[model samples]
Target: MADDKETAEALIADFQKSIKDAFAVFDHESNNTVDVREIGTIIRSLGCCPSEGELQEMLAEVEEEEPTGYIQLDKFLPMMTRVLLERKYRPQPEDVILRAFEVLDQTKKGYLTQEELTKYLTEEGEPFTQEEMEEMLSAAVDPEKNVILYKDFVTLMTVEDT
Candidate 1:
């Protein structure tokens, strides 16, 4: 039981250390404070940290099993670096909107019906009525009608707060 607890503590420590190392890289590359919450968020996003119950189960398992040497820190460092890069250098507004539209139109059908638009929006937690969607789509659709490309979609949706 004590062994199990030790294993769990060691695992958590290693994970935290990797996070600190990743933050150090980020700090050196771009002068910014990497808050603990950000580390937790990234850990959660990566699906690494187990839930309370899962952690308990792992502890029990570790007690039963022979001790494997401590987890290699290098294996996780690259993944941490990748996550930092993704969050730090996110896509531009136009690129993001364009990718959203492209993803919604995954079939490459060149157009999305009202229902499809609503489904995509709902999945993104940005639900809109058919009428509201039509209004946005109508405004965004180009004259030639080659779908509402990314730039136009960004222009229509992004608001400048006064």
Candidate 2:
């Protein structure tokens, strides 16, 4: 996976301008930051599909303990870069399903243990039911290791609905 600087540069090269230009579209007040109200519109315009609630979770993740409601251009650029790259490289369904886990896996281990997976599924934004969570766990987790690698998660998520 590309580091933030590499991803930002790639997005800038692809767009032929700084990612700040994209942020400016949402920075209507010209305070150099976009408030929560415009974050979804901005992200959508950049080709992401985070729900309102999910967007809130993303913002919280970015802000961490600070919990800022707005995103500055600097912050938004990196976030957008990651989103674009994930869409560009990861299979779409897998990208969608892995986003929250990616955020939760801040250690960059690229895998989540069953316990970690359980915590994410039960997070406040869109908590999963026990059965749904267990079903997903059974499908994606390695039985021996009791962990879900992102590759496995993607494979499980992209399976055709029966």
Candidate 3:
């Protein structure tokens, strides 16, 4: 599995150029520093999907050392690199996510209803806590249809290998 994926250095190297470019945009004074508050915006610009708590954690890391509410390009790069390297932060393959849903669908429906998902996620192995269920449903479920909408979700969760 490791052999099939890009090396850590390679992944960081590929990500750095764009990260640098985006950082530059936020560094208004051209002083290699950007407002710490804007870090989340910069991160999201790169298609990074960090939750609010995660963003706060990342922000804390960048701000703790400086304590000036600003982060240098040098400082920001390493943190963003780690985010890119974290497996949980990376998007899964569309087919893989779709297949996982398919396995649970049981009735051959492409989507799972809220109750069906509530049962699976809450009652199954390593059950999700109520908070987790709410977070997932907010993202993946369709309120009108009361279904998981995995097909549309696959688009949001997967990145094409280029």
Candidate 4:
């Protein structure tokens, strides 16, 4: 449990740092934010091949109220993380765990809240002990959002196998 918590914390810290570094590049105006137009460039700089249209769509999905089309780091991080994860981890046949994730992330949101995951696990899917569920949630759930990032979920699954 300690190891899992440490791993989760490290992963989150790394994620935050990566987003900060990337956002700094396009935040040339130094307002600690980037315009929607620069998102494509940022994605490209991250070594991900997303189309202009795709980048536009992701910007549209930002949940915050950005009247000027300028998004802060918090709003931009999730979309960037999702794009990078999708690029890095393809849904191959060998990745059976991904099938389970797809079922939970029904909206294709690339993340799942604890409620969403617990609902499936408790009702329709394989049964888990209360302690087991708690442990999984502790290891994978993001403390800030109380949700599981798809990338973190993947890491949790991968780590469990080893």
Candidate 5:
């Protein structure tokens, strides 16, 4: 009985350590708010803990499981660490917008339609709605003038929200 208790305590300690490490990665990587769902997904994939259920229930399960048998923490930690690092190093919003414009300008025609912008954003795996694209163009274009010049496009792209 004592042995079981000891194992349970040790396992809990290790899990706590893993959670801390995971949070550190999130902190390092996140420029904006960290999405709770994304963190939960990462935690579940590591198999250090179960993905769903109340926190108390999850802790109880960890306490019940013996420390001697579990996934290798060493292996899982590094993978999660890499993910956090990548997120931390991700490009800024301006860079993303600039790249999007460049992609839309591939034909070098100096203007982009809603369809082109949508296709570019989709290929980049960035989420963009048709309405959003239309709105962006509306703000950038003087519709009485049907073309968006490159300079105007860049200006709109880099404008910081007040």
Candidate 6:
């Protein structure tokens, strides 16, 4: 619908701004360019997980012939925005998500109470904010037993590629 298109456009604009800001950090010379070698690191730093081959292909798409060791902002923006909007980096695999939850489960109980998930999420690496925790819990938790329904939760975490 029109709303979906508008939302997607807004998302791309947001990604472009964020990509530009991240790209600027590596620009160093204010040249509006980044070294081809550091492209992977830059993309990962922005939280995407493009494979080496994908990155190479993207670079190839952006530059016609032999690359000049640097990728311009205009080239970087569209590619990064596309990948981000496509969620190419996130939506962690179900097995991976299960493994992470298993680690938190600790007792091998195959589940976690709201408290257990709360403690780990708010105290662990790059801890989620209160708002983030609430959002995740609202989606992933089973209120009756107060345990996390991680299997069901996987659906919430993944986006089926359209």
lDDT measured at residue 35 in model 1 versus the true structure, 0 to 100? 30
Question: Candidate 2 at 132: error in angstroms?
Answer: 28
The alpha-carbon lDDT assigned to residue 69 of candidate 5 equals 27
lDDT of 5 at 72: 37
Order the candidate numbers by lDDT, best to worst.
3, 6, 4, 2, 1, 5
For 66-97, candidate 5 gives per-residue lDDT tens digits of 54322233433444454333333222356676
Q: 94-149 in candidate 4: lDDT tens per residue?
A: 26677668776879988988887877777764566688689889888988887898
Query: Per-residue lDDT tens digits of candidate 1, residues 24-106?
Result: 54343353343322443444443344443543443343232453332223433544544443443232455566676777787
Compute the lDDT of residue 58 as modeled in candidate 5: 31
Sort the predicted structures by TM-score, highest score first.
6, 3, 4, 2, 5, 1
Q: Is candidate 4 or candidate 5 better by lDDT?
A: 4
Better of 4 and 6 by TM-score: 6
Error of 5 at 44 (Å): 29
The Cα error of candidate 1 at residue 94, in Å, is 1.8
Worst 10 residues of 1 by lDDT: 67-76
Q: Tens-digit lDDT track for model 3 on 1-162?
A: 685465755767788888899999999999999998789889977877676687788887777554988888887898887776663344456888888889988988789888988999889876778987998889988778877888897787677653
Residue 101 CA displacement from its true place in model 3, Å: 14
Q: Given candidate 4, what's the lDDT at residue 13?
A: 67
lDDT at position 119, candidate 2: 82
State residue 32's C-alpha deviation in candidate 5, in Å: 20
Whose TM-score is greatest here? Answer: 6
Better of 2 and 5 by lDDT: 2
TM of each candidate vs. truth: 0.30, 0.42, 0.52, 0.46, 0.33, 0.54
How much lDDT does each candidate structure score? 0.52, 0.69, 0.80, 0.70, 0.51, 0.80
Clashes (candidate 2): 0
Q: For candidate 6, lDDT tens digit of each residue in 1-162? A: 999999988988888888988898899999898888778777877777665577788888776367688888888888888888777866466788778887777788767888888999889776778997998889888878778977677766765543
lDDT of 1 at 144: 82
Predicted candidate 2 versus true structure: per-residue lDDT over 1-162, tens digit per residue = 469889877665775344566678778798878776677666665556676576777676555356567777766666667667566322256566677678878998989888887887788657888987988888888777778897676766564421
